[model samples]
Target: MANLAAVVGIGQTKYTTKRGDVSIAGLVREAAANALEDAGLGWDDIEAVIIGKAPDMFEGVIMPEIYLTDALGCNGKPMLRVHTAGSVGGSTALVAASHVQSGTFKRVLTVAFEKQSESNAMWALSTPQPFSVHLNAGAGGYFAPIIREYMRRSEAPYDVGIKVAVKDRLHGARNPLAHLQKPDITLQEVEESFMLWDPLRFLEACPSSDGACAMVIASEDLAEQSPKPPAWIRGVAMRSEPTMYAGREEVSPQAGRDCAADVYQQAGITDPRRDLDCAEVYVPFSWYEPMWLENLGFAAEGEGWKLTMEGATSLDEGGDIPWNPSGGVLCSNPIGASGMIRFAEAARQVRGDAGAHQVEGAKLALGHAYGGGAQFFSMWVVGSEKS
Candidate 1:
């Protein structure tokens, strides 16, 4: 049987459009240092290092892990790099956890970062590739139509997306590290915002951010010895499918459903809405909040939008299951690091360390991320108890 693993430390750099004070190496190093400090461990304590990020073009740097090894204190230790588009962050953390769970390492450090300000991310992601269609522009162009499709099928109120935009921005105001701070954002402001992509308004879409996230995963024994409370890894799962296929359900991809199902089963959860205290899902666009609620089994098909309308996912509204107390990707999107931010925030909730945004007495939480035309999916369930 595999050994148990948990998150002993979590860290994140302030999310913003540009972090001119530091280079890419410095960006990641800052987060890594914070994670080590939080864990009360030194560089020598980390047995292995794993890093993840978006494509090399996003930062104009190829094979960043090679040069970053020394910065992360992995000079003579094993180092690995993981890439799964936007889902890279969550998957990278999972890989680090597996190293300890599989009895291959006692303690491991995982880092994910994206300096989008340094490079033209839209151009990098939209560049023509062989055998792939490029009819759409960047992510907004690709996902806008999908959102429309979901709206048509679900017949959800048009204001649902607007409500999510305001709610998450309000949530972001409470997160000191969040990129956008809209303490008093209103639905009227969102409704009046210019439409970037039909249904997606300027405020409804996530901002381009330059930031990083890091975590320290340790074996059960090491986790128990840590100074801070550890968020036990109850379950972790990843799934993927071809980006383009005939009859593909882009609204709620099957890969996402399977991944969520797998993780829920491992965590012994039959009803996510009732069993989980909260969720930090990857929702770069406001509409994705309800879309993912259904995909993750938090709501029945075609009924997810109702939850948003009823404030079920709002932390400040005293909802039953708050979705993004840390403001989620909608408020801070560093692409590669966004997903891991979700995972880290979930851990923070369970550890009772999420400062102003903490869900009261949260014992279990969910973290989720999806990327690559919504084909790549990664998720994890975490809890305060080891069982």
Candidate 2:
């Protein structure tokens, strides 16, 4: 088996709807430099670079990573580009960690991003594909049915979605790097927002953000030499199934459950709600907060909504098992970089480096991501102390 790897540095750009000031290369470089600075190291210290994103078409530039090699300081260094839809960010980080865990590289840099301002996401998603009819209008259109099914089966209250949206947007207010920091937002405001899809409002959907997130992973030996404390990787896993398979449950995806189980077993977690200090889950739609709760084994089937209703997922008093303290995907959706942001945020909490959103004395954290009809799943567990 390979040796354990730890995150020595984490960095992300200020997320926004349109970062027209910088080119894609410039945007990635900004995040890479911040990570290097946080590690108290320089580009000369990096051994390899791994870049990931949803699709090249999103940025209107094919194989943009090739042109960004120089910007990421990958000149003459081994470089790899990964694409697995929205899970690309988390998978990219895992690939970089593997290199260090294998003892093949002392230090590795991983980065993920999206320049959604260059194109409209609705058009990109609705674009016609060969032999397939474009039935759904956009992501909201595709997911609305699943959300409706969840509501029907669970008999959840109509206000549950609105509550989740309010909570995440409130949490986003605490994160300076978040794209939408609506501090004064209220539940009533979310309910009053325009409905984008049935049971999904305009505020419930994630914004098309232009941003990048980067991290530096190193072997145990190299981690001990780093200036900042490292967040040790306990377990990592990725799983995929057909986008639309027979007997598939889109509302509560089995792929997510299997992915979580694999990681939990590897990390020796028997009960996620009690074992995990905090979680950074992919919540592009607010309702996912509860859906993922059951899928991740935090609650029994049909009981995920109880956690949200009782405020157990909040960061405030009387709440436990806080989720998305970094405002999560609802605050920023760079698509390609979204998943890595979750992983990086979890690492930050464990490293005791999460600025204002830091969970007090956080020791263990879960980072999760899913994409493509909820068929692709990637997850990782990180802890403050080496496992």
Candidate 3:
């Protein structure tokens, strides 16, 4: 009693460090309106609304969905909110797809945003929690040791991270909505930048941006009537583990591996590297490009770094399976919206809607996001042809 779901519309705001011109509600409304326009539909066409964001403490606004409904024209429609730390965006999109796939709704709107301009995410992240002792200062501090361990196990060169930073930034330069436009960023510059953590440089980390991303998901019948070609949802999966657990593998978390395996199986992908034309993975830190490359089965365990060094993931480098052609989180990170942006970008690629960063002949794509000590994992597969 389930049906197919497809993304009929995708929208994103111009990511930046601050958006002083609009309130948080206004920011989300802008993205929602854009998505509605892209779908060639009006507010009444949507039957439900799902919104997501990081902690309200990040913005000092509690229960934002109550007020956001009005801005989204969801006054009388069913509205829901989902949260999973940084993976919230991807999870939100999956939830919206579920409503359509379950045959409970014909169409739904999903949006995720983060107004980091008014919120101090770093401060909130660094705060101490009751059960966990956070010896690491910030995200970088926590992930640095894990990255170092991967380097030791893989024996990757020291410049592999630098190469990834430059590659993603170069990809970001092609995206007009990216926050940090460094088309000319060099590996030497990244290598020389100040080291925030033991192995992560200032340039190798993602920027805290203020923006939102929205998507319109519709059932098979509604999607067939869309004005634009639909990116058919092939599969979706989510998995989570405790924040800190004994004998946990932080470098390549089991949750992430299992989630990818589940989604790929649903999509009938026996080899992610061969089946997917491109990918938009969550790589907040530069080293994560290689780490996730392995975790996602793009490469063999210790050989993921070799793919990066060979420019296999670079769009401008004429790589076959380009990753993050839209610049990715390294270029613009709207916290709660980052993962949705990745999912949307993958859809854009499959629909042949990605402009300058378009992966040629991209009929299949993968979008992935992870959070909370790499314990939370969400992934989806999309294709031009419905599965």
Candidate 4:
């Protein structure tokens, strides 16, 4: 219903455990600069900026975008900060794209980042709020129960999680920008890793990395004139529900399903696994691959693990769908930037610029992100050609 929008540039900082060399502003600028270079444009070409992250407490800085405007080249331009828990990155990009899609801006810049080294994520996640039970443990503690429920409901083997860990780690090795490049990763090693939660091992959890991801989106006309091939945004959608509500299924949230359905409808995808050449899903935990596979309609409920077991997610398997060729969140998770990385990776596949992690002959790709007790979801479908 709005003017078509396409991604002309994508950039990301090298992921690391600690980016002490640069301040948060500097980290974001590096990504923004790279995106501009890739777009064959300059800071002067950007009309506005959209920044996203999880929580201010994580960095001990409130309203960081205000101080970051200059670093992001947003002086004298409209700027917005998006925070939808973990899906903030994807939501931020979607908001920026809307400006282009509405014909309100020719080119817009969107950036997301997180310096987890600034603070312990476990402590940040466990901060107690009034009238809420304090769960002193970290994200693994919060999510392990949901995974346990999935295992029980689906009858998934215990080794399925280990398999996912091994696969994603191997995939991460191919992504030069990934934080964890465990080239020698093996299923035996994953199985032997120290258990963090009941069923989750340290290797199965996403790393708290310092990184940033950025993208330049433009209107259809502007994109057509760009030097680089544009990754046309076929569809974008976001959905949210209360963090905890009666009758809500935490493992397969309705928000994720509804968001996928809306985007798929706009993209004209009748069969996701068959139509989508690849996907970049937010999987901070290895188990989420199969859980999302089912939620995204790539496989029948209780059968998602079957795909993972069959090596259907591998790049060389010639499987119907390849997911997380960028190594995904399991390999590098800058909480604020994780979602944008997924979106950016999808764009890269469509732009034919994924380098070693590229899915062969990829034409259509899905990008997905979720946050906040799995209650928020953002997704986009991209293609090589204009729709």
User: lDDT by residue for model 1 over 1-387, one digit each (tens)?
Assistant: 668899999989999999999988999999999999999999999999999998889888888999898889999899999999889999998998899999989999999999989988898988887896766489999999999999999999999999999999999999999999999899999999999998999999999999999999999998999999999999999999998889999999999999999999999999999999999999999999999999999899999999999999998888999999999898999999999999999999999999999999999999998889999999999999997
True-vs-predicted CA distance for residue 110, candidate 1, Å:
0.4
Q: Is candidate 2 or candidate 3 better by lDDT?
A: 3
Q: Across residues 61-153, which tens digit of lDDT does each residue of candidate 2 receive?
A: 788877999999999999999888788899999989998988899999999999899866677667787899876477788889899999999
lDDT of 4 by residue, 1-387 (tens): 878999999989999999999999999999999999999999999999999988998998899999999899899999999999999989998998998988889999999999999966777889899999998977788899999999999999999889888888888889999999998988889999999998999999999999999999999989999999999999999999998878989989999999999999999999999999999999999899999999999999999999999989977455568889889999999999999999999999999999999998899999999998898899999999877
Give candidate 4 misplaced runs (Cα > 4 Å). Answer: none
* Pairs that clash in candidate 4: none
TM-scores of all models? Answer: 0.99, 0.98, 0.98, 0.99
Rank by lDDT, highest first. Answer: 1, 3, 4, 2
Task: Identify the runs in model 3 with alpha carbons over 4 angstroms from their true place.
Answer: 134-136
Residue 224 Cα positional deviation in candidate 3, in Å, after optimal superposition:
0.4
RMSD of each: 0.8, 1.0, 1.0, 0.9
